[model samples]
Target chain A: MAIEVNGKMIEIDEEGFLVDREDWSEDVSEAIAGRDGIELKDEHIGLIDYFRDYYEEHQVHPTMRVLVLRLGGKIGKKFHDHKEYEKFLYMLFPSDPISELCKLAGLPKPLPSEHDG
Target chain B: MAKKNDEKGTTNPELNIPLLNELEEGQWPSFVSDLKQWSKTKPQVAQLLNQLEESYENRWNYWTGTVLNVSGYGGGVIARLSEKADKYPDLAEFHTIRVIPPPGFVYSTERLRNLADICEKHGAGILQLHGLTGDALALGFDNEGTFAAAEELMANGWDLGGSGPALRSLQCCVGQARCEMACFDTMKTTRFLTNHYISFLHRPELMYKFKIKVSGCANDCANAMIGSDMPIIGTWRGPMQIDQEKVAEYIEEKGVEHVIDNVITRCPTNCLSLKGKQMVVDNENCVRCMHCINVMHKALKPGKDRGVTICLGAKRTLKIGDTMSSVIVPFMKLETEEDFQNLTDLIDRMWEFWNDNGMDHERIGEFIARVGLATFLEGCGIDPDPRMVQSTRTSPYIKFEELAPGLFEGEQTQQPKVWNREPDTREPSD
Candidate 1:
C-alpha cells in the first residue's frame, strides 16, 4: 500500500505501517495521527521522538518496565513512580500509548504477538 | 549498540538490512509484504504469497458461503464452500470439514493414512492436524465430495466432531495406559463424558461453547489448567512413594551430596528433606507440582491413592480478565461408575445454570464473574470450601472484634447529618 502525501507517493505495508523508515517526516506523522483521530499535541510529539530515538538504540521494542525506568531519567517530572505517570499516559492515548506513538512515528503496526510497553 | 549516523544524516549502507531496519523503527514490519516484494523475481512464490495475502485481508468475507448442515445426530460438521469460488475456479470445490477423533486422539498409523487418502481423493490432499478443539480438519472438498468423505469416515468407525454452542471433543492426556504417573484412566472418563453428551455435541442449544480437558498428573501437559471450563487435573493425595533401596542405590551411584543439592534442594515448597540415609516428605506441605518426581524418577513416584482435582471457571479473557480455575473439588475418586455419574451430574448442573443465565456469547467464566462465585456454587449444589477461594481478592480486609461492636448497635436513633446541599433555586434571580 502507498499513501499520497503532497502528490508524492510514500510506500506503506498492508497494515498501514510505513514500508521505508527514511520516508518519515513531521508531515507524515500528522497525517498518520489524523487517521487515528489523534491530533498530535507537543507532548505527543515529544513521546514519538523519544520512541524513535529509543528504537534506534534498541533493536527490540522496550517493555513497560524498561520504559518507566528510562523515561524517568530522560523526561523526569512526576515520572518517579509508574502509577504517577500512568494516568497521564493513558489520558494521552486511551487505547495504547505505544501503539499511538508508533503510528505517529511512522513505524509498522505491532504484531498481535508483541507485548506493549 | 547505538550506531553512528553518517554526515549526510542517513544510516550507513553497511548497517541497513531493509527488513531489519524496518523492524527497528518502532513497528511490527510485515514479513509477508517483504517476502512478496523479495519474491517479485520468483513468480511462483509471489503468486502463492498473493493468494495467502488475499486470504488474510478478506478472510471474513471469504469465510461466508453455503452453510451445509447435515441431518445427523452430531453437531460440529461445519462445511462451507469458499466465497472466492468464483475468482478461483479450482477453489469452487473448496469445502472444509472438522472431524472429531476419539479421546486421547489415539489413531493407528493405518487409520490415519486411510483418512489422508480419503481426503486426497475428495478434497485437497491435506488435513489440518489440529483445530481450535481436539478435532482434525479436512480442507478443500466439494459438496458431493464432503458427503462421500463423511460416509467413508463413518464406515471406518469415525464420527463427526463437536461444533456450535456445544461440548467440543473432550481432550485428555495419555493416562495409566502409557504414563507411570497416571492416577486413573483419563481415557475412560473422557469416553464416558463423550458418550453421555453425544447429543449435546451436535446441538447448538447453549449460549457458548464449553470445553472439558483432563490431564493425568499435575504436570498438566494437556493445558487444562487455563483452557477448559472444567479442568480435571490429576493429583496425589497420599505421600509420594519413596523407595529407600532405590534412593540408597541412586545416592551411592550419584553421591548423597549430589542428590541433596540437585533433587532435595529444588523442592519449591521445601517439602522434601534428606535425613541421614532416608528421605522424608512433609505430605501436608506438598503442592503436588510434580517437580521432585520428575527430577528423581527412579527413587520418587506419585502416590498410589490418586484421583483428580476438579477446577471450575478457567477461560480466556472476554468480559472478565483471563482467569485460571479455582479448585471446587479438592480430590475425587474416579474408579467407580457412581463417582463418574456424580461428576457428570455436577457438569450437567453447571451447564444448566449457565444455559439459563448466561448472556449471548458470554463464557462460563465471564458469567461467574458477573453473577459472583457464591451464586454459581449454590446453583451447582456445591458447598463452599476454603480450597475454592480465589487468590485475586481485591479487598484484603479482616474484621476485628472492636469493629463488630458497631454492628450490634446499628439501629441508633441519631439523625444523619447532611452537607453540601445546593442553594434554593425556586425564586427567579433579580
Candidate 2:
C-alpha cells in the first residue's frame, strides 16, 4: 500500500512495514503512526530514533531483552533499571511495544520466533 | 459436488447419515428458518463462511494436480484455500469447515439437517459428523455462497468449537440432568462457563489450548481426570447410603458368598464391609469409584450434601510426563452465582499467572510443573495444607532458619519453631 507523506507517495507492505526502507523519513513515520491511531509523541520519537540508530549500526532490530540490557548497562542516562525501562516502554506503548517501535522506526515486523521478553 | 472415490459407486459416510428431509412428519421440524433469524448479530458466521469457502477452493487443487499443504502454529478450524486460485478455475473460492460439538453431544435429526442444508447450499453437500474433536465438519464450499450458509447456521443456533490456545467448550458428564448419583448440576455449570468465556474460546493469544472438563462424581464419565487442564469432580462428604432390608434380601436370595465376593470385596479402597445385616462404609477411605454402587445399585446410593472437588494441572504429556490433577480446593459448594464467581476468579488467577510466566507454546500444566506447586498455591492465595501435597519429593520442604535465642535450647519449654505460626497462617476459606 502507498501512503502520502508531504505530497510524496511512499510504499508499505500489507502489514504496514516500509516497502522501500530508503523511502522512510520522519514524515513517513508520522503518516504510519496516523494510520495506527497513535500520535507520535516526543518519547515515542526518541525511542524510534534509538531503534533506527541501533538498526543502522547492527543491521537488525533489537529485541526487547537486548533493548533492556543496552538501556541498563550502557545507555543508562535516561533509565538505569531494566524493570523501570520496561515500565516506561509499556507506558508509552501499551500493547505490542516492539511492533509499535518497528512500525514507527521503519523496521520489518519481527518474526514470531524472536522473543520480545 | 461429491468427490469420486476409487470405488466409483461408494457413498461418502460423512455426508450420508439420517437425512433431515426423510425423518417422520411429527418427529422433528426443520430449523433452517430459525438459523437464518439468529444470524443477524453473530459475526463469526461471516468469518466461518469466508474460511470454509477458501478451504473448498484448496481441496479442488489437491484433487487435480497441486498438493494441499496447510501449516500453521494454532489449532482451531483448519481452513484450506488454494494458493493458485487465480490460475485454476475449478479451485477458485473453495473452502472447508470443521465444527466442534459441545460436551455430551446430543443433536436432534432436525439440527443435523439444518447443518447439512447449510453445507449443501454453499459447498459440496458433504458433512463429517465426527471430526477429531468429536465435532461436525462441513467439508466443501465456495467463497461466494458460504456467507449466507453460515448466517443460516447461526440463525439456527450453532457456535463454532474452541480451537487454538483458548478454552475449548467445557465438557461435562450428564450429571443431575438424569443421573441419580450426580453431586451437582454439570450441564448448568458447563453452559455458564462456556458463555462467560466465549471470547476466550475464539481468541488464541494464550500459551496453549486450555480445556476444562467436569464429572458429576468420581466415576468420571466425562474422563476429566486425565484429559482436561482443569477437572471438577463431584464428591459426597458423607457415607454411602445402604438399605439393610435390600442387603438382607440380597443375602437371602443370592447367598452371603455373592455379596461378600462381589460388592464388599470389590470396593477398591476396601472401604466397605458386611457387618451382620448392615453394610459399613469407611467414607474417609472411599475413592468414590462407584464400583460397589454399580454392583449393588438397588441396595446402595450416594450420600446427600454434595459439592465439587476442584483439581488443577491435569493434562496429557507435552514437555513433561502425563500428570493427573492434584486437589486444589478439596471441596466447595457450587450452588449460587457467587460460588460460580469464586470458581471463575480462581480460574482467572491461574490464567493470568500462567500467561505472564509461561513460555511460548507452553501449557498451564507445564507451567505449574516448572514453577512448582507451592509457588502456584502461594501466588493464588492458597495456604499450604496436607491435602495439597502432590508428591513427597516435590512437596514443600521446610527451610529451617537458625532458631531464636532460647528456643529448643537450655530448658525452653515453648512449642518448637516448626509449629510457630504466622499471622495469616489460618486455613484458606472455602
Candidate 3:
C-alpha cells in the first residue's frame, strides 16, 4: 500500500508502518493530535514523538496508561493527579485540532475520533 | 423453524431415568439428579435431556435477557419467542423477551403487528408483558431463537434493543411526545443513543448489566427513582423554554384539568402554582418533576439546563435496595457524543473493574463498596477519586465548597421510600 504522509505520499509495506518523522510535517502531527480532541504544541513534541515511536515499534498508539507511565515521572509527580494530568492531556491533545490526521497517519476511521474538541 | 421436538415424550428409554447427583438433597433433589432421572425416562435422548435439566438447575431467574422496545411493552415479540421455546428441544438455555411499552400508550391501533407476525411465524405465542423496564416478555424461546427473531425483526426495520452490555435504548417520558411535562428533546436523545450504541446491544461481554432511563422532566415518570444505572432525569437550569402563546394553545387544546391533575398535584416538589390560564413555577423549589412544564407546554419552557441528571447505581438488586437512589452525577450535560462517550467510558471502566473483581451477580455499586472505591479505581487505573463510596468516609481538611463534588457531605443524603415500604409507616395522602 502507498504511505500517504503529508501531501507527498510514498509506497509502504503492511509489515512496517510509514515511520521516519521527517516524512510527517508539523501540520500532519497537529492534525492527527487534533482528531483525538487533542492539540499539538511545541511543548507536546516530546510526548507526541514518544507516542509516535511507540506506535511505530509496537504497531499501536500508546493508550492513556502508556502515555501517563512514559511521561508521568518525567513530567513531574503532579502529572498523576487527575486534574493536573487532565490538563497535560488537554495540552498535548488540544480540545480539537488540524485535519485529515488519520489519512496523514495512514490509519482507518473505525474508532472514536480523538478530536472531540 | 419447523424442527420437531421428537423427544417431547416423558419417557425415552434411551435417555437415563433421572438420578440424584448429590447426596444431601434438599426438599428438591439435586437438579442434576432430577435431570438424570429425566435422562433415564428418556434414555435415547439422555444428552439432550441433561442439558435442559442442568440449565434449569444452574441459573434460572438468576439473570435472563429481555429484549426491550418502546412499543409492545405489554405484548409483542417477547410473547412470541416465549411461545415457541419448548419446540427447540436441543438448546440448553432459554431466553425471554422483555418488552418496553410505549409510555402513556396503554393501547395503540398498531397492536404491535410487526413483532406479532414474527412471533406467530418464528416463536411460541406465549407473551409476558409490561416488565420492570416496561418491556414485554416472550417466554418459551431459547437464546438462538430469540436472536433469530431479533434478526428477523431487523429485516422489517423493527429493532429490539437493550439486551446486553451495549447502550440500552434511551427511554423517553410520555413527554410532549405524549404527556405534557416534556421540555427537552427526549425523542431525539432516545433516537441518538439507540442509533449510537447499536454495536453494544449484542455484545454481552461488557458488564453484568447496564441500563439507561430518560424522563422529560424530574417527575421521573419513567421511574428513574430506581430503574436504570445511569438515570438521565431532564432538568432545566437556565431560563425556561416556555412559549406563552404555545402554553395558551396547549391549555386550550389539552384542557385545564388534565394539565393541573397530571402536571401540578403530581409534582413531587410543590413548585407549580396555577390560576386559570396563568401559572408560575417557583424555579427554586421546582424539583424538576416536569409536570408543570409538560402540562403548561405553551407557557412553561424547560430551563436552559435542559440536560439530564445522570445518577449511577439504580439496579433493582443492589442500588435499588435498602431504599433511596444514591445520586452520583447530580447533573450531566449530554449535548454531544463526546459527553456520551465520556460517560460511557466511565461506565466501561467501572464494569471492567467490578465485573472482573466482583463476585458473580454483584451490581457495580455493591462491588465498588465491597472492593473499596479507591481500590476499584486503582484497579481500573482511572483518575483518582478520593470520595466515591457512601460509607461515611470524609476528608478532615475539606469543606463543602472544597470537597470533591462527587463526595457526599457525610452520609446525610435523603432516602427515598422503597416500593415495598411498610404500609403502617406510609403516610396517608391529603
Candidate 4:
C-alpha cells in the first residue's frame, strides 16, 4: 500500500511503515502522522530525530525505556520523575510511543515478537 | 455458540487414530482417555482429538492462530485455530484461557466447581490442573466465548494469568502449609507479588516474558533456580543446628556403612565427617547443598536465622545457552513488610534496566549476557559481591576504573595507601 505526500505516491508496508527508507522526508512523516490523527509537534519531531539517529548508529530501534531515560535527560527536567516524563511521552503519542516515533522517523517496522503483545 | 453435536454429522465413521488409541493403553493416567471421555459430551473435544490424531499422523502441528486477548487485557488467552478448519469446523477457533490459581494451588471444592461450570458453559469443559507456569488452563474457546469466560472468571474473584511479553504466572511451592522445612512463607510471598504486580501480569510491556517462582527451601520444589528469571529460594544463615543424640540414633538405625556411603559421601563440599559414631559438620566449609541435611533430617535442622536467597537471570536455553540462576542477594529477611518492599524495589530496578537494554525476544538472562553482569549490576545499583561468583576470579582483567574510588578523579590516596604503607603496627612476633 502507499500514501500520497506532496502529490507523489510513497510506498508503505501493510502496517504503514515506509517500504523504502530512502523515500522518507519531513513531508512524508507529517503525512504518515496525519493518518493516525496526530499533528506533528516539535516534541514529536525531536523524538523522531532521536529514533532515526539511534537506529542509524545501532541498527536497532531504542526501546521505550531507553527513549525515556536518554531523552528525559534533555527535555524531561521539568517533570518530577522519569515516570512523569514517560507519561508526557504517552500524552504526545497516546499509542505505543516507540512504534509511533519510529514510524514518523520512517524506519522499518519494529520486529514483532511473542512478547510484543 | 452453544455446545452442540457435529452439525455436519461428519464424525468419521472409520476413525483410525491408532497412535491416540495407543496412548489410552498405558498403565499410567492418560490424557487421551480423559479426552475420549470428554469427547462423548463435547464435540469440541472430539474435533480436537481428531485434529491431534491427524497431526500425529502427519508429524506436524495443526494449531495456528493470532493473539486473541480479552478486552483491556494483553494476555492470558492462547489462540489455537486448526489449519484444517475445513475438515474440522468445531476446532476452528479453540483458544486456551489461563486462570491464575490461588497461591500454592490450594483450591476449595466450591471454587473448583465454579471454574468447571464456567468451562462447561463457555469452553469445551476441558481443564488443565496446572500449566507449565502454574496457571489453571481452561481450554477450547472461541473469540467471543473467551471474553465471556474471562468476564465470568473475573466476576468470581479470579483473574487471568500472564501471556505474551507480560510477567508470566508466579509459582510458589507449598511452604508452611505442609512442609516442615519451609524457611519462609512461600504462599504469602506469592500472594503479595501477585497483588503488587497485577498490572504487569495483564499488561504486555516487557522485552520478553518474565517469570517469578518461589521455593520454600533450597530443595526448590518449584524449579525456580533453573526455570524462572527471578528465583526466590528459601535459605538460612550461620551454622545449622546439629543434634548429636539424633545423629547417634540415625547412625544406629542406618548402620555406619550406610551413613558413610549415602550421607557422608554425598556431601558435595566434603564438609561432614563421622567422629566416634557422631556426625561432625565443618560449618565454615559447608556450602548448604542440602544433601546431608535431607538424609539426616531428624539430626540436622536449619539455622535459626532464616531468610531467602534471591537470584537472577535463570532461563531455558535461548540465544546464549541454558543458564542457572546466579545469586544476586545471598540472603534477605523476607518476614516483614519492609523486607518485601525492599524486594519489590529491587525487582523494579531489574525491570527498568531490562526494559531499557533488552532486545526483542531477548530474555533477562540473555540481556545480562549481552550487556555483561557488571553493567547490569551497575544499572540496578547493586554493588559487586564475592557471593555472586562461583569461585575467586581467575582472570585479572578487572574493570578497576569502575571500581576504584575517586582514583581517576585525581583524589590523593589516604596516608595508609597500599604502596606507601606504614610500618607494621603489630608488636614483634611473639
Badly placed stretches (over 4 Å) of model 2 are: A1-117, B1-76, B81-103, B124-136, B141-149, B252-254, B389-430
Model 2 per-residue lDDT tens digits across residues A39-66: 8889889889999999999898876545
Candidate 2 vs candidate 4: which has greater DockQ? 4
- The predicted structure with the larger TM-score, 3 or 4, is 4
Q: lDDT tens digits, residues B1-430, model 4?
A: 2332344324532345788999887479998888787777776677788888888998999877565656556578888777887777777788999888899999999999999999899988899988667889998887778989999999998899588777888999999899978899999999999998876676456778999999988899998988899999998888998999999999999899999999998887788999997878898887777788888899998888999999888877778888888888988999999999899888888887788678878899889878777678778888665467533244221333324546655873632112211233545544
Clashing pairs in 1: B74-B202, B75-B202, B76-B163
Go through the candidates in order and give each one's DockQ: 0.01, 0.08, 0.02, 0.14
**Candidate 1: stretches off by over 4 Å:** A1-117, B1-50, B53-62, B80-83, B391-430
- TM-score (0 to 1) of chain B, per candidate? 0.76, 0.70, 0.54, 0.89
Residues B72-97 of candidate 3 have per-residue lDDT tens digits of 12112322122223533433334455
Q: Per-residue lDDT for A23 in model 4?
A: 97
lDDT (tens digit, per residue) of candidate 4 on A5-115? 888999998667898999999999999899888998888888888888899999988875566567675654321245455657767876456667888898877654443
Candidate 4: clashing pairs of residues: none
Put the candidates in TM-score order, highest first.
4, 2, 1, 3
Model 1 is docked with a DockQ of: 0.01
Tens digits of lDDT, candidate 2, B1-430: 2332222213211221123223333556544333223323322232333333444655442322111111111222434444533333334444555454655566778888778778777665656655334457665555444555555666778765455445665778889877888899988898888777764553334567778888999889888878888899998777878898888887898888998998888877788888888788899888777888877778888778788989878876668898887778878999999999888888877776676578866778788778876677667766545456454226533323312334445774543233233334457645
What is the alpha-carbon lDDT of model 4 when measured against the actual structure? 0.79
> What lDDT does each candidate get?
0.67, 0.65, 0.49, 0.79
